[model samples]
Target: MTHNVAILGASGYTGAELVRLISQHPDIQIAALAAERKAGMEMADVFPHLRHLSLPTLCKIGEIDFSTIDLCFCALPHKTSQEVISALPADLKIVDLSADFRLSDPEEYEKWYGNPHSAVEMQKEAVYGLTEFNREAIANARLVAGTGCNAATGQFVLRPLIAADVIDLDDIILDMKCAVSGAGRALKENLLHAELSEGYNAYALGSTHRHLGEFDEQFSAIAGRPVKVQFTPHLLPVNRGILATTYVKGDAKAIYAALEAAYKDEPFVELLPFGQGPSTHNVRGSNFVHIGVAEDRLEGRAIVIAALDNLTKGSSGQALQNANLMLGLEETAGLMMAPLFP
Candidate 1:
């Protein structure tokens, strides 16, 4: 019952993470690795931390034989993932870690990505891979769209509130901070040590961050109407987690009760004791998401905080979770690593 897996963009952070997790999986085997730019090089050359494990040499996607792989993890860039995944064999289970297939509407995809979706048929079949909320759908999907790290963080705190009518839909606001790895492994002048270290700043303001589209889509759908939350994200100098603090007009007791009740049976999601907030360090390197709730100084309002490793629960770990479902294995399999702490 071991699944043979391939990582299409094996040189990136998320792809390397998929390698790390799969290396420890008892029922999955790494069959192929593809990195268009790093083709023919050993995976260890691209990511030294992975040197201890036996792995395939990186190759181009076109060279992979889909018939040999039970599933593929598409960790390519947004626009690129759409094009690459579109050409992949239809019968292969795919967990796309890019923004390309997350949104259900093709027009919205073009609006956010600034390009038309080249694979409308596949886009229509891709299941939104928010494991907690879309488990059943993902379990049966041939293609699963992994969520944006930021979007996943915010949703863990707010989705239940929206579902239970515990928060005011119009007054929601999210202030999120993420580590540099969430930016991806690509070189960017702003992500350089001299520029990023020792400081933190917000970007994509004024409701312009693309992950907001996911928020709008999921929240609105849950409320059965158009719902928008004011969201702003900041880049922190560190390298691995996301802490999302949400401000909502709601009764603290009700909000706490709703979240606790909603995730009561979920393994990866933990609802902290009321009034106790979470720290990104607590969940770093693990697939677990911790959420906390507290009453705001303003009456009829509360603060909801959620924390997780942006690379793990937010990306690769989530992809693995969905893949387990698609393969009919236990959803939490190969994802039981505890968060790394200093």
Candidate 2:
């Protein structure tokens, strides 16, 4: 059966990405494109790369007939997402690509996002959308919150180890490098080509990065304790992908085995041979996540590295993955394409 889908915030990076992927999908049709600021503009005009494909013109959210939209992907920015999603039809299946519904508690949401959640009831119903870990919940959920790209990358490496108790939770550290597109399509002085092209620097030091909230909430829940890892994110000069190098105190061999066993049957996750590291290039433009494990020279230590396209597997691809479960479609539908390689 064909599912009619609407994409809100259709002009943003993730929103455009959803269009790109969904356009190629066999069971889903793009029925509406909502980009408030760019309403009435042709999608091809806004994104020349998409000019080859026929698509709906951008329009205001209210103009779209939700009665015809079987599913919606909300790629709107943080504060705005909650407000908009709160008013959608209660029965519509939604995959939200914002931080608005990630945290379970309103207090924690305010603590991290700096505002009270306006949709308390919706927050109570939204399922966390880490596809591999929360498959069952996502399948039954009316709303699924896509995790931050960095958070998704890090969790791909750490969640298994944490669950198996193979690592020391107190000493975990994550050093991640993310591409500029992960910052979204907004205009910013720091994201300028002249400024960001040749240099890379870390921001949100001292565990202040907002994704840390997701890490804290997810990891702690798995471990049944307060588990906070030291996380620092660096912005890379490239356009896509995320490479997260995690340091943990554990038996390297055991950690590798744990990860290998955890994702053995999972379709999107690939574990490299022991001691072999992954590069962002391998998973670029694909929904695949390549993970590697290296035994440090020091005994009882391991370095776990994970790589994936920040825009694909980290956001849009993830949203689509959850949408498949919600719609009772094949879990891997429209996402089996190979990575774009040089």
Candidate 3:
């Protein structure tokens, strides 16, 4: 059962990652590669690291043969993904690595993205691709929306606590730090090596980061009430990974027990020993998320930390996990690689 796959934005960081992972997958074949600006060039020309594989030449999405592709990984940008996916064949199964279909509410989508959703019909059918929490929904979904990297990291730490009622819902705060690769392969003056290499700083202060829309929507639904957390993201100097430190109001022991109990049977999620925190380097380039819980200075309050490679567990790897479920393959197929260690 070799699944024939296509990547729509095959030249970006996440797109290249999808290629790297699928190239090693025993049950998946890279059938097509589409990069509008880089069309007509070989994948090796766009990414020399992938020179070893015999991949398809880059082309435009309009030129792809959807009838031959069993699955498509839409790695296009936010607004662009919706436009392109709207034009794709309705029968084609898709795992969109964009923000377009993540939020179920179109109004919320517009509020964050500043435009109406052009593909509302598909949005209604797309499952939120959290992999671990949404496994059953993803298995039956024709379209799956990959969660935002920061949102995924924060949720991995808080969702279990919320679900188990181990923490006070009104006082959750997520302070996350992410690597530069999460910004994608696009060029920006601020992203220049000289400017970003030696410094780290927080941005999107207050509740303004776009991934907050996902947190608001998902956490609220899980608690059967509105759940809003104060979230702030920092830009780190490194190239990959996300470390989310969460501050919650709860008993330290209960928080630790809740997280361990929730993910004890899950393969990709690892709960570190109580009182020990995780670091970004520990989960580099892998689908695993390591989480830890400890007591905060304030009584009855706990600090939770979660770490994972933003590009893997946070994006492409998560997409592959959902795809496995959709295809009825083993949920962990082609995703058993251990995290890169120093």
Q: Against the true structure, whose lDDT is highest?
A: 2
lDDT of candidates 1 onward, in order:
0.93, 0.95, 0.93
Measured against the true structure, the TM-scores of the candidates, in listed sequence, are 0.99, 0.99, 0.99
lDDT of 2 at 261: 92
Error of 2 at 112 (Å): 0.8
- Model 1 / residue 244 / CA error / Å: 0.4
- In the range 1-342, model 1's lDDT, one tens digit per residue, is 889999999999999999999998888999999999999999999999999999999999989989999999999998999888878887889999999999999999898879998888888898999999998999989999999999999999988999999888999989999999999998999999999999999999996799989999999999999999998999999999999999999899999999989999999999999999999999989999999999999999999999999999999999999999999998898999999997
- Model 2, residue 62: distance off in Å is 0.6
Model 1 clashes, total count: 0
lDDT against true structure, model 3: 0.93
Compared with the true structure, the alpha-carbon lDDT of candidate 1 equals 0.93
